[model samples]
Structure formats: C-alpha cells, structure tokens
Target chain A: MLAKRIIPCLDVKDGKTVKGVQFVNFRDAGDPVELGKQYSELGADELVYLDITASHEGRKTFTELVQRIAAEVSIPFTVGGGIHELSDVERLLAAGADKVSINSSAIRRPELISEIAARFGVQECVCAIDARLEDDGQWRCYLNGGRIPTERTLFEWAHEAQERGAGEILFTSMNHDGSKQGFAIDALRRLHEELSIPVIASGGAGTKQHFLDVFQQAHVDAALAASVFHFNEIPMAELKQFLADEGVVVRQTCK
Target chain B: MVAIVKYNAGNIYSVFCACKRLGYEPVITDDPELLRSADKVIFPGVGEARAAMEYLNATGLADVIRSLKQPVLGICIGMQLMCRHSEEGDVDCLGIFDAPVERFRPTSAVDKVPQMGWNTVSANGASDKNCLFEGVADGAYVYYVHSYRVPVCADTIATTDYCGEYSAALHKGNFYATQFHPEKSGSVGEQILKNFLAL
Candidate 1:
C-alpha cells in the first residue's frame, strides 16, 4: 500500500535555516544540513529545502549546500525558490537534489513546466502554488512568496499545472499558513478532487490532528509543515504514532 | 569498487552517495572497461526510455552491460530499460529479463498515475526469497516515484500493490531490478543496500 508522506520543509536563506511568519519577520533556525540530517534520523519521509534567498550568490551557496546535504543525508529532498530557468533546474539536479519546485517563474512562463517535464521526467518537476482565500470566497494564486496576486485561481492553475506535466501540486494556503489553526481543508479537498496528480498539502499544520484532517478529509498525498516540527512542538516519531494509531498509513521509521 | 553505470540520466549523485554511505568508492562511468571490471555494477537511470536507449546504444555500453557476469542492479527506469520492451517510448529494451514494461493507466481517479511516496514490498513465489531482500522484512516500506510499472511475471521476486499487483522487484541470473529508490528509502533501504554489498 502507498503510505501518506510526512515532509519537513526547511526554509533556507543566505545559506542558513530560517522560517518567517506568513513569509515575513524571518528568524534564524539553525544550519539546514544539520536540521535535515536530524529530520532524516527522526523519521522524516522526505525533506523540502526552500531556498528563500534570491541573490545570485545565494543560489550558488544553496547548490553547494545541496551537495553537502545529499552526501550526508540518506533520503529524498526537493529544492525550491530562485529557480528561473532550465539551467537552474539542471544545476540543482546535478547538485543531487531529487526534485525542483517552480513557482513564480512557472507562472510567468508556463512552458517552463513542460520543458522541465520533457527534459527530466515529469516526476522531477513539482508545481508549488502559494494561494490565499480572497473576499469573494475564491482562492487566488500568489507570486513572489505571496506578495503579488495572479489572475489564476488555485483550482484553475493546479489543473493547468497537471496538464502541463507537473508531477504534483504543493498547494500552500496563505490564509491558513502560520496561523497554526489547521489546513485549508475545504480548498484542498476541492483541489485534489479536480486534479489527477498527487497533491502535497502545505502551509498550516498546527497539530498532529491537522495532519490527520488533511489526509482523511482532503486525501492529500503528503502533508508538510515547518514550525511545528522545527520548534519541537510535535516530535516526528510521536506524531507518526498518533497518525498511525488514528489509522492513517504512514511509513514508520525504526528507532 | 562498485561501478554505477552513467549515461544521459538525471541524478546518479544520490546513488554515488548511497554507495559511499555503504563505504564503497563506486565509479560513475559509461566506460565499458570500468563497468566490466567492477565487483558490482549499478545501472541507475531517471529519464525517458527512447533517449536513454539511444545514449546507451550510441556509447556502445548497452552491449557491454549485457555481457557483464557480475551482479548488476537496475533501479526505476534502469529496471524498465532492462526489460524486453517499454510502452513508454514503444522502444526495445536490454532484454535481460523477458518481462515488458507498461505505462500505468490507473482506473480509479484517486489512484494517481505517477505513484509517489512510500510503499510496501512482499516476497512472492518467484523464489523462497531474493538475496537482495535478505534482511529486509516482508511488507517493509520503500520510497518510489515513477509513471511506468511492470506487471507480475515469473521473474518477479517481490510484488507491490498500486492499482493492482505489479513486479516491485525482479531477479534473473545475475541481473536484479527494483521499481523503487532504495537510496532514499531510509533504514529499510539501508539494510537492503547492506545485503547487496554483502553479495
């Protein structure tokens, strides 16, 4: 049976680990490599290192950091943020990153999705959509780390991304992210219902029950969180136990 | 030293790292001499079948791979290309195993095409047990990410259920193939790698 995945997203900035509240007020977390190694040991199914750094030098550093993590850690990981073209994807994959998540640039040039899928199998490109629920009760996709809004709604963009050869959709609810209340259950349920590709739910994971809610209610392929796992609010093993006891099929790592 | 056969594929870096983690200085090469002489050869691939076949045939490593007498392990697309044929590109494969590869046409809407994430593998009746899964438990979880799969056949040593039962692992003579990524499978995968190294 295919088990639901648990991914710890490490937001990397300036070659160090950091997490911001709603994409602002960033604070130092720790070294990304160390944090990744810890997560791998503590039973993280996969890791996502979002390179929040935008500078040219920052990308170079992130690529080098990818090599270090790949060499030391024994698990799959996805690298995102600052990937603008095929060359960026090539460099990151060459650096040993398994998958590359594309956001703003992909929205700017939708062809980037197909290009990546064609060159490197479709399974390698993850289309990450940062969306927020608007006043009209529609989820609007955002760009530039949720700074700017796009005309494409969450469902439409996710459907187009799937048609364009994206392996999966990483939908982050801007309204629920950092809120720690729970996941955007209703929006996520509709998104997965519409798209054929696997959907990885992200943004607001406050408790272990939230993981259960997203998986049971929405049937997402994976659930990802940053602060909950990073700050030791919910340990990976204990959470996995909670989910397993509650009857969610998650991969249990040996202690 | 173990040799990781390299062609026009994406990310053999993790395979190299996995071998390094097992304390072997595996060489990534298309050079026939290195691959032919190595203690073990791991043909790891992640790309389209037609292009990969072209690269293998062009470099003449395809024939060399067929002649390798030592244990050879194929992963994901590596396992696909080792089969008789693939529906992916409608191309002929290495024919190391008699099985043919087919693209997944999932019937249920909920069952995704590219089956991603961790899944369990059970030892079937292919043999009492495949040596590759010596220490690994039956129904042990491993990571997988692919769009194509091989249906159950006589060569199937292990089977996994997606939409239905498929050959998760196969063995024929000296060649071994898996539809999952053991390098990224964490502890269970580490044990499988240790068993392969012992072989």
Candidate 2:
C-alpha cells in the first residue's frame, strides 16, 4: 500500500524562510536548516525547499544551503525554484538533494524533463504545476510565482508532463493560495481521474478536516501546506493520527 | 574499513554519509580488490536490478562479491539482486539467498505499482536476536520506495506488510539484505546501521 504523505513546504529567500499570509506580506520565519531538522524530528514525510528569491546572487549560497540542510536532516529533501537545466539538477543532487523539481524550465522546454529523467531516472524528476482557475471555469497554467499565465490547460500540461516521464506531479492551486478554505477539489479530482502518476495536492489547507477532505474525497497521494505547518496551526503527528482514525493509511510517528 | 560498491546507483552518497556519521571512513568503489580486502562490504543501489547486475558482471565484481567471505549488506535493489532471480530484468541474481524477487500485485482496492513510504516490520521467531533489528522495536516503521519485493522465505529475519507480507530483512549466514533504506530512515535507521557496523 502507498502510504499518504504529509509534506511541509518552506519557501527560502536569501537563505531564510519567508512565509506570507497569501503569497504577499512576507515575514521572516527561521533558518532553512533549522526548520528542516525540526520537521525531520517531528516526522515530516518529506521537506520541500523552494528558493523564492529571483536575484542574481551566486549559486554558491543555495548549493551551500542545500548541503547544510541535507547534513542536518536524514529524510528525503527536494529543492526547487531556479532549476534551469541538467547542470542545475546535477549540482543540487551532488549538493545532497534527493529530488529536483522543475516548473518554468519544464514549461519552456518539456524535453528537459525527459532528459533529466533518462539520466537520473524519473523518480528524481518532479514536475510542479501552478494552476489558477479561470473565470470561464477552466484551469490555466501559471509560472514565475503565479504571476504569468501560459496558454496551456491543466489537463494538457499534466498529461504531457507524464508522457515526458515525470514520476510525480506537484499541483498547486493559485485561487486557493493562502485561502485556507480547502484544496481545489474539482481540479484535483480531474487530475486524479486523468493522470496515472502520483499527484501531490498543494495550496488551501485551512483545517484538519480540509486535509481529511483532500485525502478522502480528492484521492491525492500527498497533501502539502506552508502557513498551517509553519505557524504550528496543526501538529503533524496529531494530523496523521486524525487521518488514521479516518481510515487513511498514514506513516505513524514512532512513539 | 567499509567499502560501498558503486555501480551508478543513486543512494551511494547517503550510505557514505551514514558511514561518516558512524565514525568510519567508507570508500565508494567498484574495484574487486578493494571490496574483497575491506573488513565489510556495503552493496548500495537505487536503480533497476538488471542494469546493476549488468554493471557488476561487466566490471567482474559479480564473481568477487560471490566469493567474499566477510559480512556483506545489500540495500534496496542491492538486496533484490541478491536473490535467485529478479523479475525486473529476468536476470539471474547472485543467488546468495534462496528467495526470488517478484513484482508487487495490488489485490486490494488500494493502488498498484510502486509501494512507497514507511511501514512497520514484525520479526520472524526463528532468531532470538536479530542483527538489524537489535535496538529497533518489533513494529517500528522504516522508509521504503520500491515496486518489486522479495517473497517471504526461511531466511527472512523481519517481515513488513505492504500489498502483503514481504521480506523486510533477510539473512543467510554472513550475507544480509534490507528492502528499506536505513540511511534515510532517521534515528532508528541510524541504529540499524550501528548494528551492522558492530557486526
């Protein structure tokens, strides 16, 4: 059985985690390595570090940050944001990332996914899609921190991503961003019904029941949250226990 | 000294890092002489079994590994390749253990194919003391990410439930294999490595 995953996403800017209420009004949270180690100790299924900074700072700092976090935590870590090519993937893997996520690069050159998949295997490649619900009731693909919209539709992009050999799809809803109402259940249901690859549902998880709704109703493999976890609105172990009570098979923390 | 067999697998760095954490310097190489001369050999892999076996046979490390008399530990695909045969490539294995690796068949309503994430293990009663599960509890959870699994056999030291009861840890004389990745499994995983090192 594939156990449901609980991932805490940390957005790093200038090597410091900056959490916002709704992708705006940023506030300094803590250090990346310290937060990663804390999450590992708290039994997080996985940790995702996204470099939210878009400056021309040298790559040395980000690679060093990855190394520092990998040294502190023994669990699987994924690094994303600013990965442009095979060399970027190689650098992060060499720096100790278990997986590399590509978003805008993948959108620009879909072949990059296949190339990386062939070299490092599909399990190492994760395709992140940020989709926003259009006024016409269609999901449009967004990139560059949900600032730009591509002409591609969600289903088309997801199917092509899988065809290009992505092991998993990380789907984040723009409309649900920091809404905390719940996940975009309709979009998730459509993706789960369409694609065979493992789908990780992100964005808009306000309460414990929201997680339950996503896991039970949406049938997503993993659920990711940022503010909820960073602000300690919900304890991970307790959430796992709650899911377990709901008959969802989650990785229980060793007592 | 610890020698980790390097055959283009993904998890070699984690294994090397784990050794460093244990106060031991491990050499990652595919050379036969270095592997045979090491106090213990760590066979770590994260790719397909056929390709790994192909690399071993091409490098002539297959014969060296089969003839090694010291303790040897196989991790993940390394463990799968130690069996009689693997379904991944229909390739013959090292035959260190009498078991055969089979693709997981999802019978229940749950999803099929890759069985990822963590699960608990229940030890077999044959051994009063388990070498890998020394400090680990009976139902402790360990991280796993694989599609195929080895069937339970007489050599199984610990069993975990996924699609069904599968071999979590297997032992035959001095040869040991684990389907889970101890290097990525946190504190309990570290203790398992410590037990392996203490051996």
Candidate 3:
C-alpha cells in the first residue's frame, strides 16, 4: 500500500521561505533550505517549494536554493511557480527536484503538460489547480495565483490535465484556503472520484484532524499545507503520529 | 572510489549527494574505464527507456555496463533497462536480470498507474540474506514513482504490492537493482545506500 503523504509547502520569495514560519531552532524564516531541512528531519513525507514571484532573477536563486535543499534534505520535493516551459522543468529537475508543479502555464498552454511529460517522464509533472467555488455551484479554475479566473471548471480541467499526461493532480480550493476550516472535503471527494491518478488536497488545514479528515473521508493520496506546518501549529512528526493512531497509513520513522 | 554511470537520465545529482552524505564522493562518469575500475558502480536513471538505452548504446556505456564485474546497483529506469525487454516503447534492454518490464494496466480506474509515494517492501526468495537490505526492516516504506513494473521472477529479491506484486528489488550475482529511489527514501533509504556502500 502506498503511504498517504504529509507535505509541508514552503512559499518562496526571492529564494527564501516567506510567510508564517517560526521554528524556535531556526531563527531564519526566510531560509527555505533551513526550514526544508527541519521538515524533512521531522519526517514530513515530502516538501513543496512554490516560488511566488518566479522572475528571471528569482529563477536563478530558486534553482540555487533547490540544489541546497536537495543536498540537505534527503526526502523528495516538488518545485512550483514560474515553471512555464520544458526547459524550466529540465533546469529544476537537473538541479535535483523530484517533481515540478505547473499551474498558470499549464492553464495557458495545456499542451505544455504533454511536452514536459514527453521530455521528462510524466511522473515528473504535477498539475496544480487553484479552484474557487463559484456562485453557480461550480468550481472554476484560477490563474496568476488565484487573481484571474478561467472558464474551465475544476473537474473539466483536472481531468484534461491527467489526460494530457499529468501524473498527479494538486487541487487547492480557494474558498477553503487559509480559512483553517479544513480541506474542501466535498470537492476533494469529487475530484478524487473523477481522476484515476493520485490527488493532493490543499487549502484550509488548521488542525491535525484536517489531515485525518482528508485521508479518511476524502481518500486523497496526499495532503499539503503551509501555515499549519510553518507556524508550528501542527508539527509534521506529531501530525503523522496522530494520523497513525487514527489508523491512517503514514510513515512513522523520522530522524 | 564509487562511480555513478552518467547517461541521458535525471536526478543523478541527488544520487551524488546521497553518496556524499554517506562520506563517499562518487565520481559521475560515462567513461567505461572509470566505471570499471571503480569500487562500486551505481546505474541510476529517471527518464524514458528508449532514449536512455540509445544514449548508453551510442556512448558504448551499454557494453561497459553489461561487462562490469564489480557490485553494480541500478535504479528506476536504470533497473528497467537492465531487464530483458520493456513494453515501454517496445524496446530491448540490457538482459542482465532476464526479466521483462510491463506497463501498469490498472484493472479499474481506482488503481493508480504510477503508484507514486511510499510503499512497503519485503524480502523475497533467498535474497532476504542479501546484504543490500542490511538493517532495513521487513516492511520498510520506500519511495516509488514508476508506471512500468518488473514482474516477480526468480531473480526478484524484494517485492512491493501496488496494483499487483512486483519486484521492488532484484539481485543476481554482483548486479542488484531497485525500482524505488533510495536516495529520496529518507533514513531507511540512507541506511540501504550505506549498506550498499559497505558491500
């Protein structure tokens, strides 16, 4: 059985971890490599580094940081933000990222999925969909970090992303994001039922129960969070232990 | 010195880092002479089988890899290429393990193809005595990300069940391979690599 992953997302700006990181041991919140090392040591199944502003200069810094994180953190990690082309994926993979998450670029050019999957294996590409619940009772996809909304619905685009060659679908509900209410369980279950590939449920994880809820109720392959892990509200090792006690299959050993 | 085969593959850097963490600075090279004289050879890859094999054949590393007498370890696509043949691109492989690679044909939609994330691996056959496992537990969770799988055969030393039971690790003579990425498999993985290095 594949263990359900608990991933801590690091929001990178100018190559440093930003927003809601407070580890007493590490004084530097902006240092992604430091925070990432901490998380991996705590037994977080994986880490996701999302470069919010992936400018040309930022790309260089992010790549360098990826190399550092790759060396220090032995666990697998996924890099996202500013990944527009196959070359970008190649650079990051060459730098040592286990996978690359494509969001806005994939929304703009759906074929980019197949292009990267062709050049680098499909397992290397992760299609991240930031979806907002619309008034019409449908979930619409968003771009530019949820600033611009697209006509594509969550189910339609996610299914297409898989058909195009995405190995996993990372669904983040804008409504549930940062609300700390829990995962968008209903939407997560819907997406889980729709796609054959593994689905990673993101957004609105305040407590350990949130992880347990998604793993038990929605049956997501993985659960991701930022502030919950970064702010130390839910330490990865404790959260994983809590989930394991709840009978969720999680990696127990953390060094 | 340990030498890692450098070919048209991905994530060789992480392998280098893993070895470095274990206090061995592995030499990443495609030169057959360097590969043969090394204390150990690590055949690691994360790319398409046809392209990778083509590069090995073109660079003459294919012959070098097959002829290496030292302890050799292949990973992911590297392990697939060591098989007799692969259904992926209908390509022939190095034929070291005499196993065939088959694409994951999930019987139902609920069964995922790539089988990504951590899964438990158990010792199989006489390979339970294989030193590669060493201090690793019987059902240690190792990282896996692959769509193609090698069916259970006589050479299979370790097995993991995803859509079905498949060879997670194979050993024959001095050659050993694993479908999982020990470099990215956390502490259990580090110990496995340490065990391999000690061999």
Quick one: best lDDT, which candidate?
Answer: 3
Give the CAPRI rating of model 2: acceptable
DockQ of each: 0.85, 0.45, 0.82
DockQ, model 3, C-alpha based: 0.82
TM-score of each: 0.97, 0.91, 0.97
- For model 1, how does the per-residue alpha-carbon lDDT over B134-186 read when each residue is reduced to its tens digit? 88888999989988999998899999999888999988999998899988888
Best to worst by DockQ, what's the order?
1, 3, 2
Task: Tell me how far the alpha carbon of residue B75 in candidate 3 is from the true structure, in angstroms, after superposition.
Answer: 0.6
- List pairs with backbone clashes in candidate 1: none
TM-score of 2: 0.91
Give the clash total for candidate 2. Answer: 0
- Residue B46 of model 1, lDDT score: 88
The DockQ-based CAPRI class assigned to model 3 is high
Write one digit per residue (lDDT tens) for candidate 1, span A187-237.
889888888899999988999989999999999999999988877788899
| Candidate 1 lDDT (Cα, 0 to 1) | 0.89
| Residues A102-154, model 3: lDDT tens digits | 99999999999999888888899999999999999999999998999998999
TM-score of 1: 0.97
DockQ pick, better of 1 and 2: 1
